[model samples]
Target: MDEDSDAQVMLRVAAGDRKAFALLFDRYHASVARFAYRFVGDRARAEELTQDIFVKLYRNAKAYKPTAQFKTFLFRVATNHCLNEVRRGEYRVTRSTSSPADEDEKGVEAVDAQAERPDEAVAGRELERAVGEALQGMSERERAAFTMCRFEGMAYRDIATALEASEAAVKSLIHRATLAVARKVEALQAGIGPERSRA
Candidate 1:
């Protein structure tokens, strides 16, 4: 749906229109789940978190202002929920493996397993693990901003609104997080090739 239509639907949702609410859920569920998965790096927990986030959104629908774009507003809810979940220490962030089928179910584009060389696939997994580990080491705000900007492809302005931070602050957070993740991935790549020790 277009932005204005989304806002109108949300207005209907705020008025206790169940169908409108369902429509919003259908439209955003996958993206919300993917954001959660990227945030926590756990598919099962991400699923749980997505459900919780939607429940919270339903309860708080009255708080939504039509002035904000629905996508940003939805992500504001999602970003805050994710930060709260992590801050509560509900789970430790870890690299949870997902099969290609599983990622596909979540609307993630999984690499073609048949097309990739086995060694390249292994390297890709290692890089994912490295990036996940780097994310795990980040502060809550940094991680949230980073995931929104990188994984979700959100603009900095939208991310700033979702994060309730200044655009400059969001920029700083993403920059640091990106640099850290890049360093980890680079180190992992360096270790994978010429640096490997021979038995």
Candidate 2:
């Protein structure tokens, strides 16, 4: 079935179909977990949050409206849960100190080192770290907007719906976030340049 058929499955779930719910869970669990990990930066906590989101989805199945795309509804639920966790100070973006097991289990894409020299690979990892730090420094709304647009490839209108903000506001947040991250990355590159340049 087409992936957009998620709505049909959701309708079935709303009508009390456990098999449909299971299919939906199997389809979206990994994606939701990855998005949560990107937002929270902790594999274990992201897994917990992913479980909570699915539980919410199951409990609120009757509220699913076909008016919007099912993906939008799923992300809206996820965004609210993540923001609440942040507000409660239960979420932390601390990938640097995460345990080896957490890193191994994390679903975020790693810096690709294939066919690259050692120096280039090192630079790639450094750049990835810098970008991650830049994202963490953004305001919650800005980070959410930037991540949805840039990483998740979501349209501004859909993101606005998920965030419950105006499209213009989402655009502004993403614009500022992009500039901030770019500036930080440039600074990181400069800092990592030759020692003679720093002298």
Candidate 3:
């Protein structure tokens, strides 16, 4: 459904409509799970976190105002929960050791479908690993912004709202994070370690 429709469903959820809540949950569950997975880097923990996020959304539905896109509101909730959990040391974020085929099965991250050649597939895997390493090294805010912007395809303004930061600040976070990831990926491609690449 479109954002307007999602907003209307959320309003119904706020008014105690069970079906509406279910519908919203069905619509966004996978994406939220993917977001959580990216944050925690573990499928099982990400699933648990996704469930908690939805429960929190249901409980706080009354506080939701349709001032922005429904996604912005939803992700704001997700972002806060993830950052809080990380800050509290509830779970440490680590790179997933799952192979490309495993990630494809779980829909966590997709290997390029066009990468049929062995070398192309290897390059894709290297790039994915480098990006994951870069994300693990980032500050929470930078990681959040970069994931939303690059992976979730969120716009800068939407990310700013979700992050409760100014657009300029979101842009800055994304820039630094993206640059780091890019450098790491480039280093991998150049047959160098990221630290040496930085040097």
- Residue by residue across 1-199, what tens digits does model 3's lDDT show? 5899999999999999999999999999988888887777788888999999999999999999887788889999999999887887767667557767755644324224346889976666666666677877888899889888877778999999999999999999999998888778779868985446546
Give the alpha carbon lDDT tens digit for every residue of 141-196 in model 1: 88788877776677899999999999999999999998877777667767853123
TM-score of 2: 0.83
Which of the numbered candidates is closest to the native, going by highest lDDT?
A: 3
TM-score of each: 0.80, 0.83, 0.87
* lDDT score at residue 30, model 2, on the 0-100 scale: 79
Cα lDDT, all candidates: 0.77, 0.77, 0.81
On lDDT, the stronger of 2 and 3 is: 3
Candidate no. 1 TM-score: 0.80
lDDT of 2 at 85: 87
Instruction: Please tell me which predicted candidate would have the highest TM-score against the true structure.
Output: 3
Give the CA lDDT, 0 to 100, for residue 14 in model 3: 96
